[model samples]
Target: MPLTAALLVTVPVFLQAPWVRSAPMAAALFTLPLLALALVLERRGQGQWQQLGVLLVGFCGSWLGGCLFWGWFRLHPVMHLPIEAFALPLAVAGLGGRWRLAGAFYLGSLLGTACTDGVMAAAGLMDLWPQVLNAPLSEAPLLLQGAAIQVLHPWPLALVGLTASLLVFVCRRLWTLGGTWRVTAAALGTTLAVDTLFLAAALVAPHLSGLI
Candidate 1:
């Protein structure tokens, strides 16, 4: 699961490189590694195929839901976060085990996606449309210039981490309160950890590479 998480977190960053971004099939090619890793992980009994499938579907559904909602109502992007936070847990709940792992991976993807944007922004490598809608809405000016990461300021990222952590900790205390509360805590906690790791990478990698 950790390996899968790592791959999920790093793949987006890999895809953001100029050379990979230029290749029409780069995204598909990059996904191959994840597919391979998923297969290996499943074989090792790290997680079931159903869980992985659920995670992927839930993750994709979150984006699709956002797009559809945005298209229909054009709500502020800030509104979409709550929608996703609500929808994702519901989407994974049916899987019936420690499904928070799925949420972790899903959120990990968000982190990777964010880090990828940050790297592109620092390197001036972004040339395509923003890969995630949040980037355009949150960092409109940067998007216009074919850059990314303008929205990845530390405070907002830290706030998200703090919120997720608080929710998870609070939920843990509520486990005896109900199943729903327990699940919610797991989902929020896992998501928070994954997001923190990615945010840390996004903030630090640029400095390490002298891109900032």
Candidate 2:
């Protein structure tokens, strides 16, 4: 299924995170252990360690979801949206019934991609001379797309991280319930806005300079 490839792609990307920049081959090997941890966290239940388990699981699941969506669907250029945008956010809303939490998951995945891309870009990974469009050429178009994401609609990496954090935090604090559908509606609305913005920006980005 998509989850497998998502996990596969997530490994190297995390290892190649702009911050680390390990050799491509080595990065894959490095993330093998994390892969196992990801499985454990994903399967973890709501017991004493539930919070921590899901926290780690959310990160991995979101990351894997994005990678799998992008690789499986072949949504290139701007893979941030189509990749993991709808599915995972919807999952958060469905599973936790918390808009803030779901929103956070959406943004956190974007943020993860953003951080990976940003670190690489800063380290000269994106500086490679190759562009499908006319803008600044980068090595991985996915990374470029990650860099291009925004906080409000298009959903930047920081936004994802913040949203996920808020989701986890608020749920724990308030422990509210009975608003599942409302939260679901809000989550869907948020996804729609992000999709609209991404499409609009994509069309306009070609004509503009580095504004994208």
Clashes of each: 0, 13
Top-TM-score structure, candidate number: 1
Q: Tell me how far candidate 1 lies from the true structure as C-alpha RMSD in angstroms.
A: 9.8
**Residue range 1-212, candidate 2, lDDT tens digits:** 11222233343233334222223334334335654664465456454244334334444445455435433332243454446554554555636442333334444445444444443344343433234233434433443453454232333444445554654454334224423323323332333334345434544453322322
Give TM per candidate: 0.35, 0.33
Give lDDT per model, in order.
Answer: 0.42, 0.40
**Least well predicted 10-residue stretch by lDDT in candidate 2:** 1-10
Model 2 misplacement above 4 A? 1-14, 18-48, 65-75, 94-103, 111-212
Whole-model lDDT for model 2 versus the true structure? 0.40
Candidate RMSDs in order: 9.8, 12.3
Candidate 2's clash total is 13
